[model samples]
Target: MRKVLITGAAGFLGSHLCDRFIKEGFHVIGMDNLITGDIKNIEHLFKLKQFEFYNHDVTKFVHVPGKLDYILHFASPASPIDYLKIPIQTLKVGSLGTHNLLGLAKEKGSRILIASTSEVYGDPLVHPQSEEYYGNVNTIGPRGVYDEAKRFQESITMAYHTYHGLDTRIARIFNTYGPRMRLNDGRVVPAFIGQALRGENLTIFGNGLQTRSFCYIDDQVEGIYKLLFSDYVYPVNIGNPDEITIKEFAEEVVRLTGTDQKVIYKPLPTDDPLQRQPDISKAKEILGWEPKIGRSEGMKLTLDYFKAFSKEELRKSEHRDFV
Candidate 1:
């Protein structure tokens, strides 16, 4: 069986990747620090002899025995709430963590994929962001910790690819939503659903006009899977291009949950992107990948998953202890 090392294997995206690889008959070595990742996301694979896990921080060093065919570097605090609370750790994961993985990949002659984000576009000046568009970013902003981390991650990955002749792929992931997402992660989808389920009003920031394009988790995983195998070395945007405003999405959530929750507005967080939509031309042209799941279909599945949470679970997840 082909062996692969997946960092952040317990995260929403990473867990799904683990499942996909396991399905494809790969011996998967999963690693995470459990800082923002929940082991529960990948606990199902514990029974499988092919799935091995390590509860270690990638920022220090990464050592995996045997041959590694691929390495997916997905270890980083991905959300605003998590990164803001632990800025240094977030930076280290993207920079130092990524560096360690690149070295490991070099040593093992493994193909490595780095998880880049749309946030690298940074409140993008371009509508429907394409991979070529250099982003307009506030380096000193609160959100820079996460954004810059991703940017640096991409740069280093490319450097290794050119300098060391490492096989590398970079997926510029956009906003994705689905099962296993943390309610209190402060991302829009889970936050809205959590509020509605808790009988609380859904909160909107920045006048609700700020737009985002949400890709479903399954589609996202598929895109990443395809990218990993494809020979493309540059970044490819993996996200649904269907864009919606924050206010409109809140209404959709209320309808989906069959709740009579009100929508409340709050000040927009600093450096929040007003518009985010991916131009997936490269993904389509190269990997022949585009999101097959529409928002309605995807949202229903996601909502159903969150609806399974007990009231106590919902209550406790109402606020994440950032500390």
Candidate 2:
């Protein structure tokens, strides 16, 4: 059996990746700090003989014994709310955490894949951002902590590849959503779903004109797995290209939830991108991967998860009232 290490193994994407590897019969070692990631995500995996969980932060030196075949570095503050609250940790994980993982990969002669985000193309000047776009980011802005850190992550990853000739893959992931997403993470999908379930207004920033392309989690995970095992070295975009305005997304969520929530517009945050989409021509040609799930289907799955939570909460409240 091949040995694989996954950082941030308790996170939404990391957990799913862990499951994927484990199901494939790989001896998977999962490492996480439990700072932003929750244990519940990987608790069930502990019973599996092929899975091992470690409560270690990757920003420090990562010392995993034995030869590893693959390392998937998915550690970082992925959500905007997470990076905003813990800027230094976010930067350190992307920088120091990435460095440590790259060193480990070199030592073990293992193929490594790092999770790079589309945030690198900050407030992009291009409509559909390809990997070649240089980006139009303000390094000093409030969102710069996450953007700059990812940019540096890519830089260091390429340096390692060029200087050491290590096999490396980078996936420039776009907005992804599904179950296991934190309801209060301040991401648009979860935030809208949570609000609609509670009969609260769905808040839209800046006249609800800003657009985003969301990829379902399963499709995102499949794309990443293909890139990791493939012989691709350069960054590949993995996301759905279906673009929709914030207003349209909110309406869809409300419709799916069967909620009568009002849409409330608020001023946009600083450095919020007006448009975001991924050009996956390279991905299509190289990896033969494209998102298979549509937004409507994806939203229905997400809403079902949230609905379960809403019912649980309501049951608890009613019990208290009866008491």
Tens digits of per-residue lDDT for model 1 on 153-218?
A: 999999999999999999999999999999999999999999999999888886999899999999
Per-candidate TM equals: 0.98, 0.96
Task: Give the alpha carbon lDDT tens digit for every residue of 1-323 in model 2.
Answer: 99999999999999999999998899999999988898998999999899998899898999998879999999998888888889999999999999999999999999999999999999999999999998988899988999999999999999999999988999999999999887777788888877777777888888888899999999999999999988989999999999999999899988888889889877788899989999999889999999999998999888887777855663332210000
Model 1 stretches with alpha carbons more than 4 Å out:
320-323
Relative to the unseen true structure, what is the C-alpha lDDT of residue 199 in candidate 1, on a scale of 0 to 100? 97
Worst 10 residues of 2 by lDDT: 314-323
| Candidate 1 residue-wise lDDT at 316 | 92
What C-alpha lDDT do the candidate models reach, one value each?
0.94, 0.90
lDDT of 2: 0.90
- Enumerate residue pairs that collide in model 1: none
